[model samples]
Target: MRVRIKGDVLCTLLLVISLSTLLYSLLRPTAKQDIAPVKNTKRLKNPPRTAASKKYYDSKVTGKVKLLSEDHHADVDSEDVKPTVPPVKTQSPFDFQQYLSSKDHRNFSLLINQPNKCTKPSGESFLLIAVKSIVEDFDRRESVRKTWGKEGLVNGVRVRRVFLLGIPKNKTTVSLWESLMQQESHYYKDILLWDFLDTFFNLTLKEIHFLSWAEMFCNDVKFIFKGDADVFVNVENLIHFLQNQNASEDLFVGDIINHAKPIRSKKSKYYIPETMYGLGIYPAYAGGGGFLMSGVTMTKLAEACKEVELFPIDDVFLGMCLQRINLKPVLHEGFKTFGITRPSAAPHLQTFDPCFYKDLMVVHSLKAAEIWLMWNLLHSQQPPCSQKQRIKKPFHWKKKKTKQAINAVTRLQVN
Candidate 1:
């Protein structure tokens, strides 16, 4: 009985211990706690704070923002920014108002009345005397045409119309042309006009007047004598010289300078900028001191003037026009252009002294009175006006035979 009780107690004790352990486990688990997942430890290993990762991020951001270049990504501070160029404006095709409003039209009537002030006359006519001024050193024309005009021959070719050119500043007086017109009208054919100022000729205001006359009276005239007033032209000789040459449509004349810059001096009356004209060299006949283009050339030049902007200097402007047409200037030595200082002694002198009237065809820069005197000197035996003043002597009667002899002598002298 004692052994049985001891075994039972041991069994009871084992049961109680098992029960207590079970109850403790069940009660404790009733208060539940949740646990989160473990973070990526590999991400921490390659930290975003590192320089390589930061640079990669920056590059990726830049690539993604490229489309925002217009607003934010443009290089505004760059020195190589292209400049904005303005479009070129074309001129109106035909602006008559512009013609009337141009600086040239300011004194049209005044200029017409004073043509010789800036221009010269063309061929001599029954009622007109052509005139010009030939400035050789400044003009750069040949000195051989003086003889050609007088000898009535040029390079085995004869030309019609007188092409007188070049007159220095001193030779041009205000009323000289009018005075010449009035005095020589009896002998000429018609006075076609030309001048340095003929914007076509690149002349001054006074010279333009001369050139305008040709344009003005082109309808009323035929043929031209574009010569210098300063020159001593033998009208008869010039008429004879040009009679044989065939009338040519392309009578491009003068000692043509190939390329020349139109002058643009601020102080000068003639000023032109490069933007105004595109051509660098004159393609047309230049050196107006003594050149002869056809009346058609004048027409073409006038037409071209409408299309081309006026260059302050005339010859170069004309050359530009001629170049456009692909025509060239024909160099003629017979169109005596400039200086022959000692023409009397020099070979092929284009200009000579008034005293050398017999040999001189065109002596540029002469006075009206001097021209008249020289003409008289060439054609007549005595001077027109005595250089010295002589007091009149009291008249005295002489014997009839002696008077008759004196009268005969006086008549011979007068004739």
Candidate 2:
């Protein structure tokens, strides 16, 4: 009985040892797989720079992609989509010098392969260059011209050149360009052009102004006014302002916005970029409110322009160029840059009158009729009866004060 029991115990121990050995062998592989040793591997080989090779690896993958399309393509089509021929990238054709010499200097030359079809104007020549855009309405243009045009010779002052530029339009903006050119072409002979060609090449409009001014100079233009078309420049007043103010190379006369910073807002038409004009004090330059630049100043400006890079914005760019050469922009009090509300200062004689033409230099953003009226007021042989007013005030201060003084003297004498 004891022998049989011992044999039974040995058999049980052998069976348990065999089972444990089998379990260890199965679990050992799983443990090894779970905790496998890491190894560093070499990177894949790179393809060549050519487009064909680039398709294989660089720009595109020419290899087949497994598709599970509901409507499977043919086996051949599914194989791979390869390029027939590779495209090539080339250099741009922009000649800076030739572009500068072109009659129309505004707009980018790099993008547009074609030249301006318009001819270089000649005979009975005067160049009136408008920096901004001309409005579509011919009436507006004619109205301004009638007022500003030289009446034979206004008090011995001559209107030599008149060029109007509409806002900038590029090749992409062809429609705008066509319309603008058409509007001016009908009436104006010497239509001057300007664009991003200077700015793209990093050249200033001052250079264009310089070149145009040089071409015309004293022979054509007696006084050159550089301003926005939107501005209603009292041409007669502007001429007087230039002549009476002793216009010279060092002198620049205009309505000045005095601040380190221009009024910039997203909604405002005067929105300037932070990149172009960073936050800081800006030196006061003449506002776009019709600045009267002397022929002498134009020459100086033209000469100064050769050295400076083109800045995008005209007025500030002009200011910067002037600042570089130590030319200061003179603020004319007669110039009403930002228009007045009737509530502001009453129109004093010699000071600007919101009512009558009390030495009004330039009024900007005027409608056609308003421009006509202003012009008529300035030129008409008849004196205007009374100043137009939104609100009529009693007691004319200038006359009433004189009468009061006389009355005081009489009363004192009687007493």
Candidate 3:
């Protein structure tokens, strides 16, 4: 009975011990569970201490959030953090040198040429005057044709006049201009048309092309006068000047400028950058407004043009050509490129005088009205004004009237 009682006590003791151990385990918390809640609460209460810390926190949290919210806005803040894009590059408009130096532009084919316009096998033509004109300048062309450009004899030398023209810019205008040119050619047989653009910069092209034409057709011509359409040429005085010159000697005559510098200002219409010409001083060359060259000099200049690179400025480029051939231009006092400055006298007091322009070979910048008036005045047989003060009066005369008077005088003398 005592042994059975002891066994019951032992079993009771073992059951109490097992129950205590089970209670302890149920009351104690695990390490991960205890720290997880504390960490989340701390993060919610305190902001990040620095940009680096904030970035780290945002990277960790936003990575998961981005993946979950991709359908709605994955890249909402991404653009703000992205790097800036670079700007596009642009081309320069003043790079004319590169355009000029291009190999494709080295040679140009003639669009229109008059091979037989000035040709004379027996060499009867004493002077061949080439007037650089545009296709659309019909009024100016007509004025020239009627005034100084009339085809006839000047001082007993047979003179021929031809107008130089180039292609128009507009395609529609091209056909119209071409048709008109064809009719003009048929009627006057004086228009020399070419295929290049007739621009201020392309005046050198006109010069070179005319030189080529002269070589082909007018080889035997004694003198060649290259002038602008607006100029008044005294063919009589020009012939008289040529009469004194040796026909075999090369002659290049005009109002010459020496040591002319290339215009560097970008704002100027005559701007020429160093890329076109690098020289500090330009050799002497005649103003392009009007110039005179003998047949031999024209041949030499034409040959020189072939070897020298083309310059945009016609006068400067001609100077370069002359430099290449070791030739120089003769300066004439009477070749007025700038229009004759009017004296400070009353218009009524200023009577038109024919003697004033009788000695001048070329007078530039004349209008059609002035040219006509001058032509009429020169033809009229009025006695010379005997005003003693007239000799002392500033030699001021209207351009058109002066040209007309000079041309009329030329006609009278030649007849």
Candidate 4:
């Protein structure tokens, strides 16, 4: 009976121990449960995420995208993302003078074949007139041919006119124009053709080529009248003037500008940069509109030009050459480069007048019609205006008084 009682006690003790272990296990925290509560707390702290927000968050966490700030992207639609613009390319400054200096002078070639014109000329030819004309200036060339360019005896001296030209720019019209030029040459026999482009800058090349031609062909020619086609040249007066001047005098005469400064404004037609001519002041040069040079002076000037670098401005370049050779251009009042001014008060407003241009060797900026008119008026037997009626101050006279003076003069001359 005692042994049965002890076994019951031990069974009771084993049941109590089992119950205690079960209670301990039920109260203890597990790793999974602790992690689940932490996740729940984190979810509560952050707002409930939409699909886009979730995707964005995932991308942000993975560092897969660079998104604009909330403020920037707020107004922008998701589909309308702004693209970045590429930077612009900057060009280097163009150095025209340097480019000209770098070129080989020996590469220049003559296109036209007028080998015998300058060579076959008689020893009596006193002046070889070279009018620097462009290929496209057919009208101007015609005007010149008919007017001042008509070759004949002037003041008992033989004068020859030759138009210097370069290649045309228009490729399509080249053949047609060339054919016309050939016909013109055949009929007139007065065109000097070179292969280079006829640009304002390349006028120096024309001068150089003409000089070279003169050196080879008409070396014994007494004088060369280098002028433009637009200018109205008083060939009669010019010849007379040349005859009067000492032939031995190294004559280079025209309207000379002594203290002209280089134009710096880029927008100007005469714009010259420091790169082209670094010098502040330009040497005195005859207004390139028209100038006379003795054969000796011409040869020396050509030699001087050969040693100097090519300058774009034809007049300025010639001046530089003259400076190098220690030759100075003689300034003359008869050479009117700025054209003759008309009297403001005169009844008949004319841009040109026979009386005003009677004594002047050159009057620039004359049109085809005006040139024709002047040619006719000048050649007429009766003088248009008398010496007493002629207006003296062409440049500086007051408008009203000058006009009154001109009217009085005109009436007096008529009476």
Candidate 5:
């Protein structure tokens, strides 16, 4: 009986112990159940930016592309595109198209040829006279042909003559010009026509083409006298002048302009735009009215012209060619290419004094009739003047012009 009682008490003790252990386990803290406040790691590759960072990023990147996955992370404008800059354009005052056209098309087709001009021919001419003429200037050409340009022996020396021309630029009369020119060519046998527009600026074409023609045909000519149709040439005086000089050596003589600046006025006939010629002063060049060059000098000019570029002014272009070959063109008092300025001191002097002209080689700006009249008067000689008064002395500034020309040439060479 006492044993049973002790068992019951033990059973009660076991139940109590089991119930206590259960309560203790239910109330105890676990590792997963530990809830406490802590800091976030924030280790993202492209982390969220603050207000200062967002402003800085938007201003710096011009074309920032965001991926679709970044929609949840950051904010930016969809209009964030690259800005473009407009180009700056400058307008030039000069006509570039016309200039390029002239520069590109220099070599023109030949319309008429005087192949036998130097052969058959004055074979080897003592003087090859080339007059710059036009189709409409029939009277002028006739005057030149009758007077100083007469072919054959002059002063016992052979001379040949040719008139350089280009197609008439007047569209209204272009058709009629062809037939008239052909007739003139057949009659005179002295027309050297090229298929270029006969304009003032295109005179450069006449210059280079004539040089090439001279080289091909009149290779043996002793001398060449190039002049305008209006100028009066004393053939006898010219022949006398050439007799003293050797044609084998270089000789170029005319009324040379020294230290001349380009005329920039648009209305002037000799206007030179800054785009055409940028230089301040032009090279020394002979007057286009008349000039004399030796056959050897012509050959040299042809070669030099091939190397140097064509300039608008024919006279200046030739001067550039001479500069290319280091050749010097001498200025002479006998050639009054600018026309005879009546002496301010001697207003009594006649403009057409045959006695005074006897000492001169060339005189410019004479009318067609004046040239004819001068030729007859000089040959017949009715007017009389003292030998001292008739003398064509050099101007006082002649030496000064020569020195300035030399200095200008030196400056060009240095440049």
Candidate 6:
């Protein structure tokens, strides 16, 4: 009976312990169980940040916002920004308005001059050959010097030479051109350079200035032959022509153009606007190609030129000066200032015949080679004009020239 009672007690204690364990497992709070999910939710809502990653995210957001404002946006601080549009330019091919606007800008200084040019170191200059020239026409000037314009005794009379010039129109090679002129002047002593830009319209200035120079200094000079560089002058023929004429008498002679009007076409290089000149007909003027005037007449021209208004066309301006002094210019047939015309009846005849040039005083628009060839042909005693010859055609042979410029400067004594 005692053993049974102890067994019951042990079974009851084991039962009580099992029931308490089951109750504890069923009644515990759920708060501690929800902790893992709460932490995961907080982590998903926000990611970890670094400097590079934050910059990348902000750049993406700003790109979307800036798309609407792109055209209106201008960064004032950025030097790279500039207007791509170019400035408006004039519509006309030539700026005639600007040229007309600056017409009063005349009276330029003499940059280079020859004060002692008329001193007549050789002899009282019986005839003065004044050629209008520009800087790049070195070959033309040399050809003139080598041929008719050579300063020395021609027909036993003193013949002096000079060139009228101005600053080169080509500005790019101005320095080189200027340097060459110094050497040329030192050697030739024939250049008359002025500060005015060398141009067709400014030839009037050259005309007046030369007349002033001659009037001031060349009172003793008997005759003057003024012409273009391109013209081939028969100086001997000219001297022979002057021998019979008196220097004291007024004599201005050339191929005179009777009735001419200013060219109104702006496209033409000789354009003259109505604002510049209003006259319907230009005054009767000698061709600028070549002309001969006595020293006395030249002096009168110098005085008359100062009294008249400046005109763009040099030849016409000279006519105005002549008119101012109540003087008339005569026409000379020997001066072929315009290019030669082949006889209409004899169409086959070549205009380059050497015989034709023998009697002419001045022939305009001949090449340097033609001048040289004609000079040689005439001096060599070629046949008369009536005979047709093989040399009648233009001389198309290789132009004879030295590899370097012929140093004629060395041959002539330094004046």
Per-structure clash totals for the candidates: 59, 18, 7, 1, 0, 0
Cα lDDT tens digits for candidate 1, 85-193? 1333433322334433564542233311333311233332211223443332212122222222232223333233322232234555434654454343223322233
Candidate number with the higher lDDT (1 or 3): 3
Q: Which residue pairs clash in candidate 4?
A: 345-403
Residues 1-415, model 2: lDDT tens digits: 9999999999999999999999999999988655532211111122124443333343332223222222332442421322212344432233334534662443332221112211232332222333333434456656656666433345554354444443343455355765556556555543544444323233344335434434443334435665544556665566666566544344577787667575455433344546545767676777765676655667666656555545544666677767777778788776666764343244433223334453566667767777777667656665443444533553254434588889999999999
- Minimum summed lDDT over a 10-residue window in model 3 is located at 60-69
Ten-residue segment with the worst summed lDDT in candidate 4? 83-92
Q: What TM-score goes with each of the models?
A: 0.40, 0.53, 0.67, 0.68, 0.69, 0.69
Scored against the true structure, residue 43 in model 4 reaches a CA lDDT of 46
lDDT of 6 by residue, 1-415 (tens): 9999999999999999999988877755465456645654564466445454355446532112221133333432222122321333334434566766775565667777777777837467899999999988999999999998999888899988889999888868656888888889888989888888788888998998888888876777999999999888888899999999999999998999887988887556666778878988887789999999999899999989878888778999999998888888888899999989986656766788776787888899999888887777776754465456744553333555674545565456453
Q: Please, what are the lDDT tens digits per residue for candidate 3 over residues 253-358?
A: 9999998888787645677777667888888888888998889998998889899887777898899899999987899988987766556554544323565566
Q: What is the C-alpha lDDT of each candidate?
A: 0.44, 0.51, 0.74, 0.77, 0.81, 0.79
For every candidate, C-alpha RMSD to the true structure in Å: 29.6, 16.7, 21.1, 18.7, 24.0, 24.8
lDDT (C-alpha) at residue 363 in model 1:
44
Error (Å) of candidate 3 at residue 152 is 2.3
Per-residue lDDT for 1-415 in model 4, tens only?
A: 9999999999999999999999889767675567755665664576446565565556523212434346545775643343221333432233465556654563477666566665455547688888989887889989988888787777677788788998876647655877888888888888888888787777888888888888877777788899988899988888888888766658899988898999886545567788768889999988888999998898898788788888777898899889998998998888988777666665365556687678889888888888888888888876676545555544444445578888999999999
The ten-residue window of minimal lDDT in model 6 covers 60-69
Put down candidate 5 lDDT per residue, 1-415, tens digits, no spaces.
9999999999999999999999888867553244311111222334457665466556532223332234443454433211111333433333446766768676788899998888875345799999998888999999998998898888888988999998788857556888888998899899999999888878889999999999998888899999999999998989999999998999999999988999886545677778778999988899999999999999999888888877778999998998888888999999999898887656666668777687998998999999998888777644454445645653332233578888999999999
CA lDDT for candidate 4: 0.77
The global Cα lDDT (0 to 1) of model 1 is: 0.44
